[model samples]
Target chain A: METQLQLLNTQGFKHTIRRLCYELIENHNTFENSIIIGLQPRGVYLSSRIVKELKEITGLSNLVNGKLDTTFYRDDFRRRSNPLIPNQTEIDFIIEDKKVILIDDVLYTGRTIRAGLDAMQAFGRPKKVELLVLIDRRYSRHLPIQPDYVGRVVDTITSDSIKVKWDEIDGQDEVLMFTDNVEKI
Target chain B: MSALSVRHLLGIKEIQASDIDLIFSTANTFKEVINRPIKKTPSLRDTTIANLFFENSTRTKLSFELAEKRLSADVINFAASSSSVSKGETLTDTVNNILAMKVDMVVMRHPYAGAAKFLSRQVKATIINAGDGAHEHPTQALLDAFSIHEKLGSIKGCNIAIIGDILHSRVALSNIFCLQKLGANVMVCGPPTLLPKYINELGVRVETNLKKALEWCDVANMLRIQLERQDIKYFPSLREYIMLYGLNMPMLESLKKEILIMHPGPINRGVEITSEVADSHQSIILNQVENGVAVRMAVMYLLAGAKQ
Candidate 1:
């Protein structure tokens, strides 16, 4: 059986989110030209929390927030057995000449971020694109992608998995890392 | 959850109910994407697809090519008339040559039944059956069901009547399979000779009277009479068939309820359905055509994504 290693509990997760929110406000002080896009599935949960915190701090009610699904753009689609389940992408406004902040829960292989870059092209060309994540698995990069804003960075090997659990979706806020020797079955 | 169980989409018979639901859900996203200002995505940029059409098709050919381009896959078009298949090249050899060029998938429309299925076995590339003679056209049926689900809110329990040319139509066969699988009540309406043998065994009601069929169905899918596929006239005459089976304004109004009209085009305007009904507000033929691209995109995306 695999033993769970808790990297961040409820308090730590909340503190990290608040810190990320403040850092976002420091760089993106105004909401006129900036849009926040969360990568679909888990990324949307974390991004929404940050967006909620930003709204509470800055009193900006109209900060453009959308979800981007990268299922169709993944490189490892052919290697998987299950048919890809696609999530909804709801971007009501245009992204032309706008700053795009892409938010996700964890950054490991950097393949999801690359796919996000490709999916973003379907909307409009952004003036600038930036990546944000709660957990950055250090030294495990498959693509040359680095996050602009990171909450925590941890060193991990290829056989490890980092899982982020949210309170809204997962019934609790916690980050866990699992070693691959213990089978998930 | 995966969208499909099978690697290649050869027919509706090979697909499960959940697979159709997944395809529809994926197509819903593509539908939104196609309506945007920047419609193209770089999702399949690294993949390559080939359109190998052994039979003549204007809409399916163009629709598949457009879907491929929208997904950003490298696309090549090959028709039998211009290819080495005309010079006595075998189907396997022709497809193998295309596969040799690093083609990852093929959307084929052939004149023989089970052609796409046969090609799927001979080659490793994913195969999407555009149309294979009188066998199946899975994507067309998907788009048809999708259009219905879009208009009617859901396909389950909806009364759908497929009218005309059941014997020689792959669309009719595929649609019957798809609709039944999705919990829709299906009825096949055509002339006695035009109706297929053992169609009742497929668990669909068969009706020869056009008026009764129209009165019973919530949606009427009028199929075009396939002049190309007909070796001999199945019915007595075109005029007689139109008088008995043709859908027009007066007949539609006689139904007393707003029944949705659909057709897998190119429509024989005055034959299976009149221009008035085809152009009416109830007609979702154009929406069916629009959904074609989205459905094809979903199928190609799923197949390519499941390549391993």
Candidate 2:
């Protein structure tokens, strides 16, 4: 337990520094002017996590909000079994004049991340936009884009997948990289 | 939870006897939950469930979503107009992507028949079919049975009249099959065109006169005549429909015994049945709605959370 917390506190600081560095360069060194938008469920929770780390270290308290849903931005909606249901889109920070750092858990096929982008557009335009993820599967990049900061990279086969279990949602915090239930722990 | 298990639940026709019995009885556990102060449970804790509805529905979707939330699951919402459906995503692909995200289960209501069942076949997630086109609404039947079982103490020997748009109602078909299985005399009444010829094969007695069906039944379940389904000429007019078969106060008063009034709503308030009659002591429409969530939760846990 102590080790996990220690790793999170230390590595989380490193992750925060990296996240803030991109914002500083893109926004021309404006410490007081940036925001974070989290995707629904995990993505939103992840942004809040990173925001905590970033705020504690930088003491700037960058604005944080949650992207409601990207279900509507799916590439194939015509034959949808059931289309996206509208939920609460929370944005405490004004995206109109601030740099937006979109945060999520995994970025695969770039679809969900794209959906997050579309959801951000509905909120308001931002001066700059960047991406962050806990794990980059390093595959399924349908769009010609990539995350600005990544925690881990696993060269994954299409057959197997990774499942990140956090206590907030799954009753535990474990960054697992599994392939067909086989582990590389 | 296995990928090779039953696919998306579009209806109950393709289900087996054991699974059906399990669902019906599992729904019985919630009889207490339904009557409690805070009718909720934490069985689905930390689970995120999405309700993707391509069609407009109030009772079914609300009840199903409530069922998920009551089980302590996180809920996601979707609609047809602003969702990916308008963006050209195929149903299977959308389901596959969402499945990829690992949402625990999906409770869906769609206009297409066999959608829920089709989804169940492809993915490993649990499927609960809210309603599909005119094909079926299994949870509706389960809840209607649950309510009937509550009132009559048993499902046997009760005569139930399913009156309204028989042609376009999957509810009528499911009720007939399920009610008859539990020994209820199933009477289907509607316009000749609205009643299919194959209904007789299901052992349901068909009549064009709503009054005739009403006189002989213990429960009268009215069906909504979909305005969209009428474009191809199933009726003369809404005026003609209300005059001929609509349930009004006088009709309720004339019935010798108080037969239960039921409608799978978004009710056409004054068209098929009057609003006053729908809210009367004899009407179980709201009870039907209230029971839907418990019944759906029961249906879901029975299929997905059943013991191996």
Name the best candidate (by DockQ).
Answer: 1
Residue-by-residue lDDT tens digits, candidate 2, B174-204: 7876787677889899999899878888888
Question: Please, what are the lDDT tens digits per residue for candidate 2 over residues A130-172?
Answer: 8878778786677876988776666666655556666677765
> Each candidate's fnat, in order?
0.65, 0.00
Complex DockQ per candidate: 0.52, 0.01
Off by over 4 Å in 1: A81-83, A179-185
Residue A171 error, candidate 1, Å:
1.6
Docking level of model 2: incorrect
Docking class of 1: medium
Q: Quote the B-chain TM-score, candidate 1.
A: 0.99
Clashes by residue pair, model 1: A83-B2, A83-B3
TM-score for candidate 1: 0.92
